[model samples]
Target: MSQQTSILILDDEPIVSKRLRPSLEKKGYEVETFTSSVDALARVRERKFNIVVTDLKMEGVDGMQFLTEVKSLYPDTEVIVITGFATMATAKESFSKGVFDFLAKPFKLGEITEVIAKAEEKINNS
Candidate 1:
């Protein structure tokens, strides 16, 4: 919390978390990852994060639902939605619900990094 750079990564795939954690940590973010939305929600309730990056296609609470919950519970927390099933509908829905950014799957690491940078800026300003 306190507006320092920290990221919470919510992805069911171990591979995604594995690839992303080191890069974001190297950039100086305090990082936490969860493969379960239930557990992530508990963590979110207990602590404030600079950003929350969640996969859109999860087994329990999918990304869209997660986005809604995040905004409702932690309105100031920036939420980035990432999905392999990228579509116009999903993009529109995410924006309508106030997602910070949307990233289609197969996106380069730099692209996600840019989104994280933007989130940091927003957090700092707020």
Candidate 2:
């Protein structure tokens, strides 16, 4: 097997993380899912992930703050935002922070996979 793409998924809801972890791992990506942003941030500090998928809303350290820190630590790492409360302002703000993509909640698995494919392509090309 080839080197697997490492991904960190952060969502407050356990169901969200549970649902995504298996699918992403099945795609041959190394996956870590976190329901807590604090733990997620600590994990990121220890190692850099190739891609990060985060929810816009969370208890501590919201998605914007999380992504900002990720970019600072590893500017090349691609970030994808998934939000239940998607808004134009948030989308624009996310883009300005250099997020690779933004997705609304209740999306199909295919949608996220497609975005991951694109992010992986960019990672490879870079």
Task: Identify the candidate with maximal lDDT.
Answer: 2
Scored against the true structure, residue 116 in model 1 reaches a CA lDDT of 93
Give lDDT per model, in order: 0.88, 0.95
Q: Output the worst ten-in-a-row residue range by lDDT, candidate 1.
A: 1-10
Off by over 4 Å in 1: 1-3
Steric overlap count per candidate: 0, 0
* CA shift of 120, model 1, Å: 0.6
Q: Say which candidate scores most in TM-score.
A: 2
lDDT per residue as tens, model 2, 5-120? 99999999999888888988888999999999999999999999999999989988998999999999999999999999999999999999999999999999999999999999
lDDT of 1: 0.88
Q: What tens-digit string does per-residue lDDT give for candidate 1 at 1-126?
A: 353487999998888889899999898889999999888888888887879999888898787887788888888889999998899999999989888999999988999999999988988887
